[model samples]
Target: MLSLQQLSKQYKNSELALDNVSFDVPSGQVIGLIGPSGAGKSTLIRCINRLIEPTHGAIYLDDVELTQLSTSKLRKQRRRIGMIFQEYALVERLSVMENVLSGTLGYVSFWQSFFRKFPEPLLQKAFGYLERVGLLEHANKRADQLSGGQKQRVGIARALAQEPSLLLIDEPTASLDPKTSRQIMRLIKEICKERNLPAIINIHDVVLAQTYVDRIIGLKAGKIVFDGSPSALNASVLTTIYGKEEWNTTPACEEEVSIAPVPNFQTKLELAI
Candidate 1:
């Protein structure tokens, strides 16, 4: 579990990126963080990971106050937080298996990792993660040879290799085509539930997020504007978060549309809703 209390971030120029934002993430829950551009969604994640220090307030992971930790302690705590990047941050020359194993670097000795001599059990675990992401067949391929979706799958597998307590995903579908984006979203949701792992995904596609995540946190100009189940994200809440637009206020009988592709343009119809 993670908690943010009165968290805020102000740049040297005194422009507030996150203003007194507070929230909690419970175990086995996936939260979709949605907002307009420059709404501080990315900033909040960076602050949580201590990549960008919070200008004020405290961050708690379990009972530990992350904001108060020493550098060495912070480094160790970071290993418990998994990160999946929008850019598919991978070593181009490394094989898919090696890339996933890199996630365990913090747990392994320097010489062991440098020599790629991961323990046999760890190697087997990496293989399991690869298979989970449907990349077992490509384990020997270089990262650069992967397509966009394959690369992101590798990214997901790498993050899971950390066996992290919480997942922090930044625009996991930002670069993929529409279908692939949906696949990645569904994959992340399933994995989080299966492992009882809590996750916070900073996402752009509102419909996509609403479809896959358990909850939605809407940000507006660096503040928490809406925090509730995806079903609560009616026209009014979305308008407040993203500014005025002709939103679909139709109270359809369906709660969440199934994510599978269908004939007669059903997938497109569901997305349009």
Candidate 2:
């Protein structure tokens, strides 16, 4: 439902963050974006959301050229695209309910939102989303009072409150511990399947991405190196994407060794043709 054509981004000094990157995300599909640090994975997402302006190229969402839309129009379009940040991005002073309802601010009238006067149905929806994220009991708690994982759950609930058609998650588990990270990832995967919301998540953990997403897109130096089903992901592709011959040299994390082989791991690499 989203397409990027020759999408390129260059800073004023002409440092390219993305280079002629192009891809399409089909509706109801969960696509994982993976790459090494500075591979432009984060930059790609920011460009898609127009959180950072693209230096050149076009982004089309269901036939509408996002790069060409007026500011006001773009703001409206943004409501259909929900973003979840790695940092949780919760307003520390706000109640969980307020934070969840903040997702609807793009739709609520400026004055009404400023006054914290969301519609009753919207409030009900917020409560429902809290329950979906298993945070219903924390509805009245201040966001600052919650743990990192709980805060991220609130973040997810906030995004759901938007009732978005597409979800953009940036390293959703980066800050949480291993167990909590897995829990959050599982919840996101389940929600995407149940809601049928097309999603694009930028992640550093290849194992998590492979386990959770329908498709994987590997990036390198601001360009796409691989894009296919998770089962198709192999060591060679990862080596090229990360630009590391010794990419798989590290010993397995206790966690990594337990489950299925991570395609990027040394043992898995040695086994691959």
Q: For residue 7, what is the lDDT in candidate 1?
A: 99
Off by over 4 Å in 1: 249-273
Distance from true location, Cα of 174 in model 2, Å: 0.8
Clashing pairs in 1: none
Q: Pull out the clashing pairs in model 2.
A: none
TM-score of each: 0.91, 0.92
- Tens-place lDDT digits, model 2, residues 54-140: 989999888789999899999988988889999999999999999999999998998999899899999999999999999999999
Maximum-lDDT candidate:
1
